[model samples]
Target: MYLYKFNDPEKALDCFTAFISRFPESGNITLVYYLAYEAAGKAGKASQAETLKDELIRKFPDSDYAKGLQDPEYFKKVDSDLRTVDRMYAEAYELYQNVYYKEALARCEDILQQFPGSKMSSYVLFLRAMCIVNLQPADEARIALNEVLAAQPTKRIQTVVNGILASMDVGDKPVLYADAEMYDARYLKSVRNWTFDEEKHAENTEEDRENPYKVNKEEEYCVVILLPEDMKTMQVLHLQTRLTFLNAALKAEQKDEKGDYQVKKEDLWYKTTALQIEPFANYGEAAVYLNRVAVDKTLLKNFKGARYRIFAISKTNFSVLKRLKNAEQYVDFFVTNYFDDRGQGEIITGRQGAAAHLFKYEADEKHDFVLMVPYRQVNVKKMAELLHGIEPAFALEKETYDDRYEMVVVKNVGTQVQSMEYLQLVSRNKEIFDRLSGTSSYMFTITQSNLGILLENQNIEEYMKFFDDNYQRNQSGEVGVGDGDFVYAKSVAHKFVLFYPNTIDPFKLKTTFEEFNFAGLMVNNVKYDDEHDCMVVSGFRNKEEAMRYFQTAVDNRKLFRSLRNVDYRNFIISDSNFDTMCEKKEIEQYLQFFKKYYLE
Candidate 1:
């Protein structure tokens, strides 16, 4: 289960198989059977899964677990039935109030069996304790009441449950801190287990635990560059980049001969307000810095209309205002909290965050790339036939600019590497050059957003200029050649930085290391990650891909070879094992999973 939760299905199934053998009569055996079947399917053991499904049906014909195999709505129906427990609990509550303890107990047990984790679960447990307290033995009542407390009921339910537990604690010490210890255990306890500890649980809300602000206005101040929500995405980014550059300049200007900055460079950080440049020790210090930035020839003058805004706020009040995200509310908070209504000594107080230095891309949202072919050069039918020859998923699209062009797009081209592989296919086939000499262009690396710009402008050369500029920048080792010209989100996909003969020289790497990507790998990019800094190739779709890349590049040393003096175009190192990328990591104990109930 742990392995499954961590997304390693093969290991999870192995553990499940072992558990089945060791504890054949485990109480959770029925649930375990279904879970193992699920793990098998996820791990791509389709034959094994089909066998497990049959075994599950034959062994437990009447179980909901078996019914679920055919009926997709089985769990939804179970949930719908459980929803009636609210009114059922009301009837049970009436019986308990009228001193019908036996009847109430029956209803509570029925609800417990039918609806295990319902919203009114805590309330039902509380009623169960109440019914048993008067009718059953002291020990029975104590056990029942402890169960109620463990459910972590509402404050009203908690007060009654805590009172009952206090009466039963045989500890001779006067229970002065009973509420503190028992009532808030749910919040404090990190791990789930049967054993309870007094020190771990204490009654506290989430807000009380998380708040990291205190009110103090006269001591601290900060310069905030607000990124108003309405600003265009590029404008905000440009402002942030400019502000960052100005900060570096300030550090250089203030540093002593010994290379120590006088203003403490550590104070520079980007928090929620876009960028908090320098947190100052006094109000006058912030004022001086802001004034310097506003008037300085190189700092603020370059950015058009670089006027900044400031406000007076104490530390604690600032957190509330920031959370509210309302300028009017902050004004009101300043009026209500500070003594002088003029609002002079205000500061934002919350300080429980690490500095954000880099912007990143998450694969949750994808920026897809496509190839645009001018219609004057090639028609959709010809393009379609050509793309189909390369990869069947590659197809021609003719939506944006019908008169002048059609685009070549592949279904879910996994990475930039896979995109390049299409071009590689065309490059390898020399007949394509003569076959379509009319082909005006093939994009080097262009995203869907770039396609929109090309379509709207209807000027291919104008759009190609951006790529031309970027290529020159890439060759010249420019940090941000494509920044102003291209519109892309700051976030980039993640790649592993570990396990490397870390070097930044892309030139040292031999050709055709990616001769292997022709296999089922279909990676997005195989370019140098942080070319100015590291020796890692950035981007892999998942852990398995990462492992495969590692095995080829690091373990097998296929990625790097001594810089040789000959034959670069004949980049092949020979026939390769595709099992590295597409092959499933199989279960070591593959047969044991089927030992008990499955057929070969």
Candidate 2:
């Protein structure tokens, strides 16, 4: 009978009813009937659920299921409220996906409250923790992460938890001191499990306790000490001894917020100071010297001479020395020696050492050759090509000397060239000619002749004046070649033309030329040849003159009658509107046109 309920509840219900009818006095009959009814209801047959409820109440009034219906809390504890739990869990999951962390957290909490012993309790707790981590404070997140970690989750969940812990900077002890000697063989061996040759040490220590110095696993602390890597043997020994003393001092002086001696701060300071010294001597003298030389000039300049104590030295000390030279050469020399060789203890001070340093210093100070070019006078591609060809020389020379020179070619195109386009071309081709040759160290200045004048002056004000003067002069009169008393106007036509050829409507040609401020305009020729069967038009003065020339050809009709039919109205309208629109649109078109013609 129980097998019927386990496999097929509908069939089991009928079997239970038949058995009850045959053996009504059986004590287990009530229990069998109750299960049959409950299984039927679970299968979503409402009639079965009603029948089961009626039978359970009538025949099994004292059963657990019957009693659960009387008290709703009892139903929840016995897993009789599975539908409600599923609905709540679904809602919480949806909220989590939408980033409604607080809502998700509340819903998960509800599951635990309503169904304390439900199988879904573990999952609900995990979700609640994740939501709390995102929505609540750092302390809450820490608690949440720890709870999740302690759960002994599935492999996938464990992997995710490990990743989250790695990203988090929680429970980390700040490094208080670092001494070079502490990393040595003796000291390293002293720290349990920290062996120089792990394989060999493992064999030797296998019989002993794996980690003898193992302190409290939960107690977190860090010690920072200077390690001697490249000092003389004597210097290394001195630093090692100092580190040991500093370590002892730190252990003695360290304290927590409650004023209890937990970790020594003085020991850390002492270790840090010892690391800074080239050779450890008296602490008082070292402290004084460090205070004097470790002064940050960058901070001093930034704060307007605000006196501040030096805490650390950085690589930027080299750059500071170079900048100090710009103010006073002697100051540069003094600062460089104090920091570079004497302070760093990288080189001894003498005539030969001094000569070598000076040679290196002079090389770094060499200036790059800058070439300025007028946009109107030179093609950018051609100039770039020329510069790229010289790159080999610069590359070869850079290999030999510490000092290097560069060719900085500046094209003064104003707003004519798009900054992005210009930069793209320069960067793409810089490798071709960006080097120096032999021992010359001199990079060439290849630029427009006009820009040469501005570079020679090195006065920005003068360059601006020159630019304005040239533009005004060009606009005032047609640019022409001087020949005694006669000035022949030079053609200012774009070398690369854009318009379709042989469809030359004199009026349209004039409009296009005027829009670009061309030196000449187009005019139609009245005379035509019968054998050629075409009328001639010439670009001459302006739009009006060009239209008049076209009209002349049309009136005569002796040239080609077909030429008279060509529309010139569009051309005339385009010319009249050219100036107003030129500033806004034509410049962009000109750039595109130039790019297509030259750069493509």
Candidate 3:
């Protein structure tokens, strides 16, 4: 009974089967047979379960099991459908493993069609969604993910669904969070205008089959922007500048291509009153000049139609532009062609040209500073306030350009700071801090920092302490704790802790340690002790129980040595190795003994 309760189904099956044979005429025989059949089913011995079912029918025709078998209308239907579903699932699983996503999807679909209301329907749906994701169609993947979320998903399935959703761009327009800070570096520059070319390489071999459709090459452009001076304002300016440029370019090209420029009567002549009656001049030259101006405007607009992405080169210093605090407040402004009716203008920042041109100088190593002033349309004051809250060292100034008000960049000087320092300050000041507090925020911050401070200090103790503290904090919370957090904490410990047995080889140790089951095992630390020729494992709640179990293996020298020699160096053992060392019968007996006495 103890072994059965500990999930040693194989051992429990053997014990129950033997007991059933000895007490065939006993009143408890039926119950014992039922348990044995259940154990057999759990151990994947479907044939053995069927045999037990047959024996129960022959021995007790009037029993419940016998009755169930005699009139199994619902069960018969379920059994027949389940077999087909299982076959389909197996085929789909195999296809998925081989990376044949389209075939796997078709198999999963077939299962749904064949067994509409089967218990395996949910699993089939999950596999179908996975196939869609791997198929590289975001629209279909999002729909599939939505279906999975709507269904009652297992924890593992939910994890996979969430991961897929995280990587996808779903919904209408993307919402830019106030807390979302863009990465600023030259490396990010490549992201702008990033093109993906899917070249089909047809092969002669069957395995090298190509996609049926010719791959289309997609050219994606990212908009980049630079603010004149203050680092804080530039963050906002970069995005706004790109958007404004896109709008302006779109409008300009539309007017030029369609020949829709508005003509005003007053603007026909610059000085109509001063012009005396004169001989007709070559009106064709004036008309040609006017047409030339229209063509130029249209061309400029078309050039702006391409995608604009913003990235600030951190390595270059924009210190000079940081001194314009008294400039006009121009974070937000509107562009107007006040005189033209058909040639109407959309809102554009006056600083569009300047902002776009700054990219040319971003990679210049000689420059220490770059300052960008956004067009008159940007709200300089509001932008300044946001900057001040994020980095107190930055100053904002207002200025005028072409008689229009615009903000100027001032010094971002307060406390000592670096590129990542600014990012941390922004992340801390952002709205995310309100939701992620205490240990949650601490864990996230530490992970996001990527051990930057620890690496800077080269302090292993501090690094280990960080992991230890977070691990304890995570364990305290039942609802909020997540496997991802635990995994991250373990990774940090693995990287920093020197005392842990970092490597495992068959020849190195006389005894083998069982691989730590991530789900069931929680280790605080690994300490090495050269004096005792043993590792002092500590910080477990059930250390006594674990030690008692260890003593049993120590007592049986041959069995103990054999168990100890098992190399569980890698997290998961190979199937061939497991089969070679322990047969089903041997595993059952050992598990039964261990579960009955070794485990608490």
Model 3 lDDT tens row, 1-600 = 313336778987887788687767654466567667777989899999999988988888765446555675644555566666766787787566544567788999888887776666667888888877666457777888888777776555677688767766554322221212221221233233122121211222442343122211121111112222212212222232223222333444564442211111110111110001111122332222223332332222322322211111111111111222211211111112111322211112222331122122111122111112335444446555665666565554543422332333334332222332443343444342322222211221123132334334333333333333332333322212122212111112111111223243222222122121112222222212322111222222332434443455345455324325333221111122123223332333333333432243
Flag the better candidate by lDDT, 1 or 2.
1
Model 2, 94-201: lDDT tens digits are: 566544566778998889897875645656667787777666665666677677667655444556666666666656421221234223422333233322334545
Runs with alpha carbons beyond 4 Å of true place in candidate 3: 1-71, 169-600
Error at 136, model 1, angstroms: 12
- In order, what lDDT does every prediction score? 0.46, 0.38, 0.38
Model 3: lDDT equals 0.38
- Best by TM-score, which number? 1
Q: By lDDT, who's the top model here?
A: 1
Q: Which ten residues in a row have the lowest lDDT in candidate 2?
A: 262-271
Cα error of candidate 1 at position 188, Å: 29
Can you give the TM-score per candidate against the true fold?
0.21, 0.18, 0.20
Of 1 and 3, the candidate ahead on lDDT is 1
Ranking by lDDT, best first? 1, 3, 2
Residue 409 in model 3: lDDT: 37
